[model samples]
Target: MEKLRYERPVINKIKAGVPDKFGMSTRINTITEIEGIPVKDIIKGYGSPVFVLSESKIRDTYHEAYRAFSTRYPKIQFSWSYKTNYLDAVCKIYHSEGSWAEVVSGFEYDKAIANDVDGGKILFNGPDKSDADLIKAIENKSFIHIDHFDELYSIIRISGNLKLKAKVAIRVNMDTGIYPQWDRFGFNYENGEAWNALNRIMLSNNLELVGLHTHIGTYILSANAYGIAASKLSELAVRVHRKFNHHIKYIDMGGGFASKNTLKGAYLPGKDTCPSFDDYAESITSAIINSEIQPDHLPTLFLETGRAMIDDAAYILGTVLANKRLTSARRSTIVDIGINCHWSLMIIGH
Candidate 1:
């Protein structure tokens, strides 16, 4: 017969209403599994400190977010941002759900192509497009969001050289009553730079102005700010039609929707405080519908939100590595993984 393994005995103490800083817990609920799979089995199959992405969770979140916007707006399109979560599995999941790839760099642009996203569907954004990058975007007929005059000029030159009409948009930055405005990339709407860029694009024979884009801020907590942004973009679209008789095809409200994660030092938890998808959809859709833009030519709304869609669908599973006895006889456990979480980040062993 096999001998039984030796075990170390330990003392324990229990108290009623033992509480964490956030609140007291009547029961210490544990996450042993997700989507019907045992957590221990997953850990054993993969390894300690592994990233687990729930496919069903990802799909469910996508459907919820998509429905929130599509049900409210006449036309809506979602583009999954590579910067948000580029894990191939994650990207594929989003792509399968009718999302185009929104990339900000040459490498990421290529990555989208590699993932078999149609060239015309890819949105090329950011301020750092190289001549080569612009050439590829022009060749692919991708939506190139011009960030500044230099990039605009580059696109014009590249498209002229290629004899191709590059689908394009101008990224407009503005004071949307949000502090520390994102005025770094794109033209300033208040200063008439955005108009100047639009005029320049309309004059260019090789560039087709398809849309107006804006990324107000990241982890934005206010749904009202999105309404303000939509109003501003709609006004620009109406002006485009008035001046050049050109109705822009779309308005890209680059994503900044907050995930359910509390900011450091925040008093309230994120789950209770973050704006809902409905809140944002109501704000943005109402603004465009109420704007001066003609109802017959209302532009398609492009949303690049990804964080809120994925935060709840993925998690890091880890195990405790060692235990040390303190001078006061208290035990301390340690783990390999490092993280930043809402409450204190402590590792646990299975």
Candidate 2:
């Protein structure tokens, strides 16, 4: 018997008068290996459709963002957004790196408590909090950001029932020059709603307003928008201090930092276009520092960035299933994975 050999075929075609936009010469950059291990070996050991998360990458990204902020600002805290890749392993990694859990529901709060995170360190933000959830959070001393008037009254009732003062903040929704502004999370700043909430919280005996939060939008490309948001929140912080003689301990400009994932309709690759940690730090830090709030009274900066910190570290591995020809003689290949598994497909065009 003779051994068989493999060969690839090639063809040449004549050039036309016009060039195809999709026919630009592209270099195929294959991901042959990851973290000193061959991707093939990983697929062989773990099988196709396996998700491989790089522990080193996760730590590096965490350290990168932490360093970027810590070096610029004196007091900075990172709270891992539990909704973003809530796998216990992933959450533990962030916790080990000194991340406090930022949860929105009772289940995530339970998970954080189970994970040994200090209850005082949990920052609870969301619109849907049950009476029982409020009771638990109040008892645990979590920083709860209020979303609506109904929730505010509910917390007051719960505080009366439990006889415990709840540490809370009001989520402010403002137009920071970003389109499709995030107005659903908190009270509107421009319409006096945020001030109304502030006054109500200040007068309440059962609730302590400890911070101010604003989440402009997600995947925000404009760094200036963050500067604007930071200034606005600082302005409110000063106003709150002047009127109520109460100081906000923290100003949480909620996370929407762009990650390295290319968004749909992006002209340049995300790696090149996404703002760096330094850019964001400069934007927000400068605004807060220049605000009327005293330098010594500068509130702790809390960041809940999720996707920007972990997306690059997570990779979905799958094998090519088959290739088929289209009506236009174009070839398309299918993979073992689909949109459900790798949710990052939302940004990348198929």
TM-scores, one per candidate = 0.88, 0.91
Local accuracy of candidate 1 as per-residue lDDT tens digits, 1-350:
55877868888666454445755433324697877777777778777777777887888899999899999998999999999878676788889999999999999998899999999999999999999988888888899999999988888888888899999999999988889998998999999999999999999998899999999988899999999999999999999999999999999999999998666655566788899999999999999999999999999999999788888877677787898999999877697556642322112221
Please list the residue runs of candidate 1 whose C-alpha ends up more than 4 Å from where it truly belongs after superposition: 1-30, 325-332, 339-350
The number of residue pairs in model 2 that clash at the backbone is 0
Clashes of each: 0, 0
lDDT: worst 10-residue window of model 2: 341-350
User: Model 2, range 1-350, lDDT digits (tens) per residue?
Assistant: 54765635535365452324544223235797877777777778777777888888898899999998888889999999999877787888899999999998989989999999999999999999988889999999999999999999999999988999999998999999998888878999999999999999999999999999988888899999999999999999999999988889999988899998766555556788899988999899999999999888899999999889988987777888887778987666788887577432111111
**What TM-score would candidate 1 get against the native?**
0.88
Q: After superposing candidate 2 on the true structure, give the runs of residues whose Cα lies further than 4 Å from its correct spot.
A: 1-7, 10-28, 342-350
Worst 10 residues of 1 by lDDT: 341-350
Task: Go through the candidates in order and give each one's C-alpha lDDT.
Answer: 0.87, 0.87
